[model samples]
Structures are given as structure tokens and as C-alpha cells.
Target chain A: MSRLNIAPTKSNQLNLKRSLKMTSEGFALLEQKREILVMELMRLLDRVKVVQQELAQRRHKAYATLRKAASHNGYYHMRNIANGINYEHDVHSDTRVVAGIRIPTLSVKQGAFRSQYGFADTDSLVDQTMIDFLALLESAGKLAELETAVWLLARELKKTQRRVNALEHIFIPNYKDTLRYIGEVLEGKDLDSFFTMKMVKKRLAEAAEAAEAAEQAQLSDGDAPDTTP
Target chain B: MGFHIIGDADTVLGYRFAGLSGDVVETAEEARVAFKAAIANHRKGVLLITEAVEDMLADDVTAHRLSSKPPYLAVMQDIWGPRGKRRSLQELIYEAVGIRIVQDN
Candidate 1:
């Protein structure tokens, strides 16, 4: 493992341990953030699915009605209808943040689609078709909001995943290795000094014992009688 | 703000009856400029871009989808619209152009 290039000193050891602790804590915080974001994303995914299904049905109806209108009268008449009548829908939107990402909330507010084509000349089917399209427009607003929300959440989810991966796979592992290397070196020095102290103490004890024995032998042998006389 | 219609003259005209104000552009380049102006305009609440121009300026439209602010882009689809159930090129062209070019003998 590639350890950080630095002196293997006690201060270095302390520094490494401190940094390792901080990194691990940071990693934990990020992991939590990722988990929360993922949960939020899954919830939003469910919403998107439901709205999408509804939107599909509405869209089918809209297109079907449009085709009916075209066939019932004439393509020109259908074109004139759009050219004759106008429907202005006001959309009120706001933003709310989820996991630090801002998403839009939309509501379509419209009263009715007015007809400029005279009621005297048009068939009721044409009016019904117009109504269907207006309803589709309202649903389309919800579809847009939901779809946009999913996009924003999905993008944020990708970013959170990247951060989590960096901490788990790269930074955390590197710090752990550096801390382990420093710990091993410090332990090796401690063992070495321990053995050296043991050896010095043993040698000093043996020298004292030998001196005591020599004094005892001289006294016992009465070598040169007592110097008191 | 006002919605934008960036497509053929007819599609833009269809929206005009609704009293909705928008731009009718011929080229994708012009549409892009018009789209930018619409997004920047504070009064623009919703944009009703037709499917034709939306297809041409796909990237710009997608980028606009990510915008957190106002002027929500809504791609309006008429009777003849893009993107639906699959059809062979021959069938697609026949349906779009209504010309019986490909005849099975």
C-alpha cells in the first residue's frame, strides 16, 4: 500500500490518527446524506410513474379527439378552429428544496377554452374535442412538473453517489493505510527499546553479584591476616 | 411571460387565436435565439414550443428543462405530432406526407 511520505515520528503518528478519525467521520456523514437522498429519489420515482401513466392516457385521448375533429369536418376546418379560438392558461410555480436540490412546483389555472368559430356552423363533436384538449393541457402541467422533479432529483442522486464513492473507495482507504503504517513503525521502536533495557539491567545485576562473591572469598580465605594488628 | 411558438407559420398562427404571444421562426438557429429570449423574459410563465422545432433544438431544450426558475417549457403536440408508437419509414412518411409513394404490388 502506498503510505504518505513523511517521517515516522510520534508527532506524525498522532497527526495521522487525528486525520484518520476526521476522515472516517466525514465519510459517515456523507453516507448518511447519500442514503437520505436515495430515499427521496425512490419516493419521487413512484410519483413520476403514476403521473406518467395518467399523462399517457390523457395524451392518447387528446390525440384521438384531435384526429376525430379532423375527420369529422375537414383539415382546414380543424386548423381554423385553432386559429379562431384561444385558450390562455396561467401557470403558477414555486420552488422547494430536497437534499439541497431545488425543484419546481407547478399548477395550471385556466377557466375555459373559448370558441371563435360560430356555434351556428360547428358540430358538437368539435366542441367536445376542444374540451378534451383543454383538459389535456391541465394534466400536461402536472406531467411537466413531475418529470422535471425526477430529472433534478436523479441528477443530484448521481452527484451524491460520486461523493460517497470517493470517500468509501479512495480517501478512507488511503487514510487507513497511512495510519496503519505509522502505528506499526511506532510499535517496532517500542519493542526494540524494551529489549535493550532488559539486557542492560541483567548485565548490571550480574556484575554486582560477582563483586560480592569476590569479597566473600577474600574474607573467608583470611589472606594476609587481619589488617587490624 | 408569454409562451413561444417556434415552428412553421401555421402552427404559430394556430396559437395566435388564443391571444398567446410568441415567435414563429423558420430555422433552428432563429428558434434558439427566440427560445433564449423567452427564457430570459421575466413575464414568460410557460412556453408552448411545437414538436418540430423542439426536435431540432433538442439539446437546448433539454438544458432548459433543468432550469430551476420560471418559464417552464411545454412542448405542444397537435394532431400531427412527433414521437409516438413506432412506424416503419414508409408508413411514417405516408402518414406524415399522406403520399402513397410506397405501394405493395
Candidate 2:
């Protein structure tokens, strides 16, 4: 019956050491990537805040203008006028890839509001109001487009950040420690072998010297044994 | 669960999800209708909206926020021009973590 042995060979030891070094190097690179990503994320966030505030103000102004227009014409009349106006709607959709992320795009046709009544009969104020409303709508549309981009980017950034953190704090450190442990163990084994070889050589030299001294004493005794002979 | 997306015609087209109901609302009234429908459906986990549409229906958005059954609403900006002006998850982190760093400068 053969018993199982579980000792790592020289080649396995070398490979382990190499792997550990590679993991540590990889971890260092990953750390740098994480830092850069975090910085980018921060900047993007600051811009988002600024944009959010601007959007809020713009929306408020647009709403105020719309409300004033509605009051002047009466809500029902304004609705009727808007209903009579012809608007042509067209939309185009596309996709763009950014940093391995696929983002959708839309191209919308800007609607032109044309009055059913003749321009001559229509009040200039109503026409101006319509134009203002359209402008506001366009602004709102643009803001929506911007917001969509911001939100999607934010989501992606968050996911990337999480991954970076995991690599930095957990995986890299564990691999590095394991590598260090293996190296230390190998170094210790080398030192122990060197000490054992020196001790063995010293013991053999002492034994040889003792044997020579004893041989010389015996030979001298034999040479001086003439009376006994 | 039903999801309603409100935005510009362009925005609505961009966010076409399989099970989501979408409305390309230019006016406040249409925005209101979409908002009501979103609230009624209650099954939507997320309400993806454009800032432009949110502007038109700020009041409705606020009302949804105050409601008990409000879904997770994510507002984003359009990415079209050079600057890439929009909201992102990174922005949320800055808001949540309160750490601000400027990388562009």
C-alpha cells in the first residue's frame, strides 16, 4: 500500500512565487485605476448637481410663462387653440457605445405649431405665447436628454466603483499576503539546510582528527616496545 | 407591474423598454396623464425619466415623491453635445458620500 504525500516540489514553489509577484503587481495597477475612476466620478457628480439646479430654475421660469399665457387666454380657449394647431412628430433612434457601454439615442422632430386660423386674424400675443410655449417645450426636451445621459452614466460609475473597491480592499491584499508567506517559508528552508550541512562537516572533521591522534600514539608505542620483544 | 416613461419625443424613443408604457409629452397635461398612469400601475420598480419632461411636470413628480407607493425614479439628461452635460451614478456618490473632486481642471 502506498501512502499519499502532500509536499510541494521546487518547480511548484517557483511558480507560486511568480504568481504571487504577478498578483501584487496586478493589484497595484488596479488600485491606480480605482483612484482615477473615483476622481472622475466625483467630477461628474459635481457637474450633475450644478445642472440639476439650473434645470430646476429653467423649469420654473418656463412654467411661469406658460401659466401667464394660460390665464390671459383662459384655459379652455388656450386648449382649443393648441388642439387646432398642427404638429408634425417624427422620431429617430440610434445607439452609441461609450467605454464599453451601449447608450441609446433619439432624434425627435421639432414640431412646428401652425394655427388653423389665418395669421392676420390671430392675435399677435397668442402667437407670441405659442412661440414661448414651444421654446419652453424645446428647452425641457433638451434638459430631459441631458438628464438621461447623466443618470445612466451615474449608474455605470457606481458599478465600476464597487468593482474597484473590491479589487483594492480584498482580492489584491489576499494574494499579496499569500505570496509573502510562501517566500518566507522557502527562505527559512534554505537557511536550515545551510546550517545542517555546516554542522555535519564540523562533526566529520572532529572524528578524523581524533582517529589520527590515536593512530600516532599507538605507532609510537609499538616503535618503543624493544624490551618486551 | 407597469412602468411609465415620460420625456421628450427623442427621450421617449431612446428609453424603449419591453414592458414599459411610454409617453412623449410636450405639454404639462400630457405629463400629468403619464404621471397618473405610472402611479396607478404600482408594479414598476423604476421610473426612468428625462429632466426635460420632469421640468414640465415638476409638481407631479413632487406629488409622486410624497405618495406612499412611489417607484424609484431616476432622472437623466440628454447626452448630445460636446460637454456631455448630464446626471450620473458618480454624481449620486458625491451627493451621498459628500466628497467632491474636480478632474477637468
User: What would the TM-score be for candidate 2 when compared with the true structure?
Assistant: 0.53
Q: Each model's TM-score? A: 0.72, 0.53
Residue A219 accuracy (lDDT) in model 1: 83
RMSD of each: 8.9, 10.7
Report lDDT per candidate: 0.68, 0.55
* Worst-scoring 10-residue span by lDDT in model 1 chain A: A220-229
DockQ, structure candidate 1: 0.16
**Candidate 2: tens digits of C-alpha lDDT, residues A91-146:** 34355655554444445455576555456534655665555545544444444444
Which portions of model 2 miss their true places by more than 4 Å? A1-58, A84-86, A91-97, A104-108, A116-126, A199-229, B1-93, B96-98, B101-105
Candidate 1 chain B weakest lDDT stretch, 10 residues? B89-98
lDDT of 1 by residue, B45-77 (tens): 667777777777889887877665567766665
Lowest lDDT sum, 10 consecutive residues, model 2 chain A, at: A1-10
